[model samples]
Target: MSDRDEQAYAGTAEGKGPVRIDEELARHLENKREELFEEFEIRDEFPPEVLREAEERAADPEGDIRTELEDRRDLRELTTWTTDPADAQDFDDAVSIERTDTGYRLWVHIADVTHYVAPETAMWEEAMERGNTVYLPAYTVHMLPPILAETVCSLVPNEDRLAHTVEMHIDGETLSHESIDIYKSVVHSDARQTYNDCEDRLEDPDAPLHEANSLAYELAEKLHEQRKDDGSLVLNPKRDRAHTIIEECMLKANKAVTHTLQWDRGLEAMFRVHPQPTPQEWDEALQEIQELDGVSIPGDAWDDPRKAVNATLEEAPGRQLDKIQWAVMKVMPRAKYMADPFGGHHALNFEIYGHFTSPIRRLSDLVNHWIVYTDGVPDGIGDLCDHASDKQKDGETCERIYKDFLQEVGLDPHAVNNRGIEVVDDPADAEYTA
Candidate 1:
C-alpha cells in the first residue's frame, strides 16, 4: 500500500495503535488529524494493512512516502521532471563547481516556482494567505498542495527540473561575484549533503563520504572560516534537542541559499538581521545586571557585538540579554520582504543574504526564487510582501487568542487578566499609547 494509504489506516480503529474512545475524543486529542479530515474531508478509512505500512513509513528516516507523493507521475510531468529516480526529484537547488584560472565558477539552479503557481490560482491564493508553512511538533501543513510544493516546485536532485540558474565566479577568498545569468534552465543536483555530515567530513577527511566528495566539503569549510575571520559571528546556539541528520540537511540547504544569493548572484538579499543594542538600552540592562551584585558578565567581551552580548549574558548569568535583545528588536526596523540587487547584509557582514532555498516550507523563499529566475521582480512582489506580513500578524493573533482560550479553559486567572499587557506595573506608562 502507498504511504498515504498507510497513514490513513494508522488513524483508524483496526490499526494496532490504541483505538480512540470515540470520533469526538479522537478529533479533540489529535488536532492535526481532525484538521486534515475536516479541511480535506476525506471520508474513506484505510485498511489494516495500510495502517501497518504507514507505521513502518513513519519510522523511515528518509521520508520516502513524502518523496513518493511529491514525485508522482502526473506531478513530475507537470513540474518537468525528466530524469531517473536516483538522479532526479527532491532537490530544490543545485550548485555546479568548476575550477577556473583565478578561482571557480558556481552555478546555482533554484526551482522555478512561478512556473507552477500562477497568481489568482487556488494554490497561489492559499499559499499567499498562509504566508508560509506552519511547522508544528508533529506535522507540517504546507502552503501549497503536495504536488506543487514537493514535486513540481522542488529542485530535486538528478531530475531534469526547471530552474532559475544563478551563475557567478568567486575570487580567492571573498564572496565577490556578479550575476552571470538568471534564466530558466534544466538542471540536476549532483548530491545532497547535510551540514553536520559535511562538517564531520571536514573535521576528518578519512570519513566514509569524505573520500568521494572532499572538494565541496573543503570549500564549505573555507567559506565558513573566511566569513568568521571577516567579522561574521558564529552565534548559532545548540538547539535543545540533539542534532538529527534531517535537521542538518535543512540547515545546509538554508546556508546554501544564503551563499548562492551572496556569492553566485550579486543580489542584495533580505536577511534575518539583528542589530547591536543601543547604548541606552544596553545601560539599562547592564544596570539591572549590576543590581545582581555578585554576578558578572558570562564570558569574554569580544570585539564582535553578537559575541559580546552573548559573553555578557554568560558572565552575568541573568535574563538581561534576552530582555535587551527583545527590546532592541523592537527598536530596529523589522526585516521584511524586498528585492535588493546591490547585495547588502549587515548582520552576517556579507554583501547579500536572501532566502532562496526551502520552497517547500517558506512562501517568501518560493517568491524570491521566482523573482531571481525571471531576472525582474514579479508584478505583485510588493503586494505579496504586504499580504504575507499581514497574514503572519493574523496567525500570531490567532495563536494568542487560542492560548488565551486555553488559559481560560484551564482556569488560569492570572493569564486571563494579563492576556494582552506586556508591562502591567510601569508607573510611567499611565498615559502610554497602545
Candidate 2:
C-alpha cells in the first residue's frame, strides 16, 4: 500500500473524521469477504454433485446440446449479433433488427440456461444458492460451472446456441410498441461486436452494416426522449450513441418479458421493483444538492421527483457532477427484487420491469425464462427474491473490497493519491552549493 492509502486506512488523515482501520488492507478485505458471505448466507462454491454433472456434460458437449434443443425456432440465418466489452467473458444476449413496412421487427435472444440445468437438479440448486455471479476487478466467481457459463450456455460467435427470444414490432413513428412474443429459439451470432466497433460502424457510411447501425441508434434516440417525457430519472449522463442503442434494446426486452409474465396471471415470478422516493428522502436529497451548489429545487419536484432530480443533475457544474450524482444516489433506496410487479422501476418510469436478459450471470432471469416456458415459478420464490437481493449487495461489497486491495498494491493508481512526486535536478550539487 502507498503512504496515502496507509494513512487513509489508519485514520491519520488531517482532522476529517475518525475511522477504525486496525488491520492491513488485504487482510481487511479477506475478513470483509468472509463476513459478507456469512451475513448474506452465500454459498461460495458449487456442490460436489454439481461439479460431477458439469464434468460429464463438458466431456460430451454434442450429446447434451442435441437433447437440449426443443420447441426452438431456428434463427441461425438471421443477421444476429452481440455487443459487449472487448474483454467480456460470457455473452448472454444478442440482437437482430430488420425494417418493416409499418415499423421495425426486433428480436432479443437470451441464453436459455434452463435447458441444460433443470429445476431441482444439482446445478440448479447451486445456481439458486449463489443467486448470481459476483464479479471482482481481477476475476469473477461464476454461479455455474465453466461447462455452461463459459462454453455451453454462452452465446459465442459462429456457434449455434439455444436461447429464449423476445420478438417485438416497434412502430416507425413514435417508436412505440406493438405485438410481443416470447419463445425458445436457436441462433448463430454473425459477429461478436464490441461497443467501440459499434461506434465505428455507426460513423462509417460505406460499411456493410451501416443501415442496421443507423436504424438502431435512431430508435434509441426516440426511446430516450420518450422516457424523458415520462419523467424518468436521468442519473447517468448521455454516453456514446452505441452504448445508448444497446441499453435501449435490453430495456425493451426486459419490459416485454415482464409484461408477458404479468399477462399470464397463473405464473408466479419475481419482479425488479423500485419504489418512489418518500418525502423525507426527497428532502434529504434536496438538502444535499443545496449544500453542494446552493441550488434550490423547484417546489413541484415533490410530485415528480424524477424530472426534478434529472433537471438538477443537468444544471450541475461539470467538475462537481460526479460528486453530486453520488450524493443523490446515496439518499435513494436501492432497487430490489419482489414477488409482484406492483411498483415498477422509478428510474426508468416503466409500469412493469423484470430482469430477463443475462440469465447466464443472474438467477432471477433464469427463473423468468422458466416461467415463460413452463408457465410456473418454482416453490419458495418469494424467499429466493430476498436472497437474490442480499446476494447482489454482497457482490457489491466484494467488488469494493477487491478494488481497495488493488489500489493498495499500486495496481490501480487511480484509486490512490497519484500526484507525481517532485524530483530535484542535481540534488547533491544543489545541497553542496555547486
Candidate 3:
C-alpha cells in the first residue's frame, strides 16, 4: 500500500479531529461515510473481543515493553526523533543517523507492532480483515484500534518503546547499500517534529537536532537525485524538503528489507509490483500531454516516458498539473501487491520494493514484520495480496466519494484534510479561518 502514486487521486496527513460544520452537514457527512462503508464492505468497528484485547495490551504498555528490554538492543541513548504531520496521533517510526568516514550509518526504528499483535491474537485477525487504514479527509478508519496505536505501538517522544530497527551503512560515493541489519530494539524518540518544524530546524543552526536534520537532508537530497537520475517518475517533483527526507528514507529502508527477503532468504512475502506503461500507451500519454496548453515534452526525454512526464511536470503550468497527471494515469496500470517481487516497481524504477513502514496502518507492513520476525510466510500469500489490493482500491474510492460529498456540501476537502473537522450545532457558531 505504498500509494506513492496517490497524487494521482489525493493528499497526505495531520490529524486534529474534524472541521467545524453544522449538525445538518455533520449528519449528511456521517450518512455519506456510512453509505461508502456499506458499499465497499469496510468495517469501521472492531469486534468486542478485539477491543478488549487492545485495551488489555494498552493498559500496561510500559510494563509489557519493559519485559522485552533484556534481549533487545538499547538505543535510548541515540538521538532519535520522529518527523510526522502537525497533528499526527501515533508516531510509528523514528530515525537516527551518524556520518561515518566511509558512509552514513542510518537507523530507521519502526514501532514493534507485531510484538503486541502476534499471529494468534484477536487484534491480528482484525488487522488482517481490514487490510489497511482508510483515510478520508477529516476522518480515518484505522486497521488497528486507537488504543494500541496510542499506547504500546506509538513511538511517542521521551518514551521508551519497543522497535524493529533497520540499520544501514550506505556508501556515500555510490549511494549503494554497504551493509544492512534488521533487529529488535528499544528506542526513545527525543522529539516529535512536524514537517514545518523540520524545515525550520534545517534553517536554524542553533536549534536542537539541527546538525542531524541537515545531515539527513544532505543524504536525502543525494538519494532523491539518484532516484530521479535512475529514471524514476516523480509525479510531484517540487516536494518540500521534509517530505523528501521521509520519502527517501522509507524507500531505502523498504528496499533494504525486501531485497533481503527476496535475495537472501528467498521468502514469499508481500512485495509491490508496479507495471510500466507500454510504449504505445506512453506515446499516447505523451501526445495527450503535448497537446495540452502550456505543456511541452523534451526531445531527449522521449525515450524514457517516466523522465519525460517528470520533466514536463517540473516545468508545466501549475493549473495543467491535474490534466497531465490524468493523461499518465489513464495510460498506466494500477500497482498491486504480489507474493513475489517480479516485474518490479515502474514509477520508482526500483527492482525490488515492499512495505516495512507504517505497520499500524498497512497490513502489508504488519505481515512483513511477522515474516521477518519468524522467517515464516503467511498461508495463501497470493490471495492475501489480492485482498490487500482490492481493499486499497476500495479505500481510495471511498475517500474520493467522501471528498466529493464534502465539496457538494460547500466544504473544501483540502482545508478539512489539513485542519480537520469539528461538528457544531450551528455553522455560524463555529470560528473558521476561511
Candidate 4:
C-alpha cells in the first residue's frame, strides 16, 4: 500500500468498513510484496511510453467513436447494460437477451480494446508482456493503464463506445446455437448494475432491468443444466444467481467464438485445452473423498468423475466440503492455452473454447480480437500461447503468496478483499498489527 492507499480509509467505521492497520505493519506488508514481485519477475509499473500513448488515445474518445460510427453496426437502440462487482473500476462486457419463437436472441458486447491498443501500439506490447491482470487482496496490477481502460474502453451507461459483439440465436429446446455473428458495433448501455443489485432485481418486479435480469437467469439456468449434463465439472454449483448469469453467458459467448474460429472459419487462434485425469487417478480421488468423515459419492455418478465431484459437492457435509474439493483438485490436470483444439477441455466438456470477452485484462482475448478483425494469423502464435499460459501461472502464484503473507500478519484475506485496507495512527484503531 502507498501513502495514498494508507489514507484511503482514514475514518472507516470500526466494524462496517476496511480493516485498519498501523504504520509499522503496513510497511511489513509493502516490503513483502516487493520481495515477492522481485522473486516472481512480475512487472508492477507500466512504461512511460505506454502510459503516454494511452493518454493520447483517451484524449478524444467521443470524437474517435464518431469517426468509426459509419463503418460499424449502430446498436444504441438495443437495451444493453453491464453488471459487475460493486467495487469494479471498468465494465468490460454487457449483455442483451430476448425470447424468440425457437429460443433466445443473445447479444454479448465486449470492449473493443484492439481499437485502442493495436499490435503496433505501446499499450498492446505492454499488455502482452504482462499477459493478464494480477489481483491481490485490496490491490491490483492492471494489464492496461487504468485511465484508458476505465475511460474510453469502458462500456459506461449512455455513452456510445466501440465494442466487439457476439450475437447468438440459441435453440431453447436443445440448448444449441442456431447461428452466430461477430462484428464491431457502437453500443449505449442503459445502466451499470452490481451483483447485489441483480439479485434484488430478480426478486423485485419494479426494479430497473428486472425483466432483462430475469430472462437472463432463465436462460442461464438452462445453460447451467445443459453443461452439467454434458459432463462439465462445476466445482461451485451453489454460486449465487447473479454470478451464474454472468458465468454462463461468458462461457456461451466464448464457446460460440471458438467454434466459429475452428469449425466455421478454419482459422488457427488461441484455444483453451484441458486434459482429463487417468482412471486410476480418478479412483484415488474418489476413494479419498469417500474416506472422509461425512462425505459420500453415489455409485451412478462414479462413471463420470466430473459428475461425481459435482454430486458430492452438492450433498457433502459443510465441514467436509474443502477436503472433498481438494481431493478432486489433487488429481485434475491444469488447463492451458494451445493453438490446436484437438485435446479439448475436459472440465468444460467443450470441443472448442477460447477467451473473447475480457480484452481489457487478458492478452489472449486482445490478440484474438485482432485475428478476428484482420482474418489473419499472427506469427509465432504458439510461442504467444506458451507465454500466456506461463504468465497466468505466475500471476496465480503471486496472488497465493501474497494471500499467505496476509495470513502471516493476522489479516483475513477475504475481509481485506471485501472492505479494503486502511492505515491509522492509533494502535487501538488497528484491526491487526504485530
TM-score of each: 0.55, 0.83, 0.95, 0.94
The lDDT of model 2 is 0.73
What does candidate 2's lDDT look like per residue over 1-434, in tens digits?
01001111211122222222223443544565566567656666677899898877567655655665655688989988887755466888888998899888999999888878888788988888898887654255788897789888889988888889999999988777788988888888888876767877888998756778888788877887687778877676645776677778888888888888887554668798887778788777767776776455566665676777777766667766777677668766777899888877877788878898888888888888888888878899999999898887887766676567655644442222222112234444221111
Candidate whose lDDT is highest: 3
Expressed as tens digits, the lDDT of each residue in 1-434 for candidate 1 is 01011111112111122211334322343563444435433222334443343344234423433443443222222212111111112345545555567655555556666666655555555566567554221223456565555665566544545566555665545645533544556554544544334345546867744543354434445555465456553432221111222222223344555565556665544333333446665555545544554545443443355444444444543445455445334444444455442434444564544565546555677766655554454566667766665554544344344445434334232222222123334434322211
* Residue range 1-434, candidate 3, lDDT tens digits: 23332331233444445567777777778899999999999999889999999888778878876888889999999999998876566677889999999989999999999988998889998898899888887687888999877667989999899999999999999999999899999999999998878888999999999999999999999999898889988887767888888888889899999989999999999998999989999989999999999999988988899889888998999999989988988988998999988899998999989999889888999999999999999888999899999999999899888888888878888778777878777568764422
| Model 1 residue 260 lDDT score | 58
Q: Order of candidates by lDDT, top first? A: 3, 4, 2, 1
Misplaced by over 4 Å in model 4 are 1-15
Q: Whole-model Cα lDDT per candidate?
A: 0.44, 0.73, 0.86, 0.85
**lDDT of each residue in 268-369, candidate 4, tens digit only:** 898888888899999999999989887889889988888998889899888887788788888888778898888988888887788888888788888889
What local lDDT does model 1 show for residue 424? 30
- Candidate 4, which ten residues in sequence have the lowest lDDT sum? 1-10
Model 3: per-residue Cα lDDT at residue 199: 84
lDDT of 3: 0.86
Off-target runs (Cα >4 Å) in candidate 3 are 1-18, 431-434
